[model samples]
Target: MAEEVKLFGIWGSPFSRKVEIALKMKGVEYEYIEEELGNMSPLLLKYNPIHKKVPVLVHNGKPIAESVIIIEYIDETWKHNPILPQDPYERAVARFWAKFIDEKCLPALWNSTWSKGKDREAAIEEASQHLNTLENELKDKKFFGGEEIGLVDIVASFVGFWFGALQEVSGLELLTEEKVPKLCKWSYEFVNHSVIKENLPSRDKLVAYLSARFADASK
Candidate 1:
């Protein structure tokens, strides 16, 4: 019998989409269960008792939390259409970029969207610096892991999807073709990939959701 796989996710969450993309890339068959952020399911709580976040990958009754960790798990378990490189040095480099984006770039990007006044300005500056670093890093390659999409590509996929929506909602334009040409080109290429193109969140819904979120935060 084939191993049973199930994914608990939220529609608009880029973190959730990362796991979904990894699953699709690996040709893993799984059931998708959409969870409401406000009222999470009991199974989700049972699976990820610590974080209780969505994008939990349950394989044969075992639960894996954290999007990157889940992606690594999927890659290690399935091993078919590998997301990470086999070479140790290359894999380490990919993990470094992935971790950097997850820790530094993502927080700066989020602050740029949600913060106001001086805080927002600082956030934009920080985010721009991170983008600049990425631009310099991508000066010689099509993807972070060279010509093919890999772990770093998956972790940074949100730059193509959520970053634009956040920019629209926040009324900021940090990523432009002229500003970060290479990064912008990579984003377009990443988003146009079959898996990403098909699975992106609806623009209208995201706009409304983010608008409400900002409004609520302001109050």
Candidate 2:
């Protein structure tokens, strides 16, 4: 019998899309199940009881939750296209940046869009700092993984696609070419990469979606 692979995800979620991108990069054939995040399905709940989040990957009968974990699992399982560095130290560095992107940068970036007054200012400041950190790290590299897309590039995929969309919807500017030119350039390169371009949600649709959501949240 053939091994079964299924991914439960939402269309607009970067986290979910990142997993999909990884799958595509590895030439992994899997079923894509779109989920309505607002209405959680029992299957999703069963697969990920703790988070009840999208981007759950089920291989055979086993389930994996969280996009990062799922991505690493896919990398390990496929082994055709290496997502992380082979060198131990390089791999560790990649992991560190990936964690930073998820835990620190994304939160600040998101808050900068929705927050107001002092909080908004603070968020923008913190987000800028985080972006600068990335800018320095990516100074001369074609990709975060150096010559090719790797763990850090995959993890920071949101900044490439959603950053502009979120900024447009919120009428905020966190990532400007003038401010962080290198990172901005990286964003352009990453999103325009053949594989990533194919998997990206339409920018106009994303802006429209986020506009309504942010409008409601503000009220």
lDDT of every model, 2 decimals: 0.89, 0.91
The number of the candidate with the highest lDDT is: 2
Model 2, 73-166: lDDT tens digits are 9988988889988888988898899999999999999999888999999999999999999999997998999988998998998888898899
Clashing pairs in 2: none
Cα error of candidate 2 at position 184, Å: 1.0
lDDT of 2 at 153: 94
Model 1 regions lying over 4 Å from their true place = none
> What lDDT is reached at residue 146 by model 2?
90
User: Could you tell me every candidate's TM-score relative to the true structure?
Assistant: 0.96, 0.98
Give one digit per residue, the lDDT tens place, for model 1 in 16-71: 99999998888888999999998899989999989878889899998889999999
Q: Would you give me the overall lDDT of model 1?
A: 0.89
State the displacement of the C-alpha of residue 142, model 2, in Å, after optimal TM-score superposition. 0.7
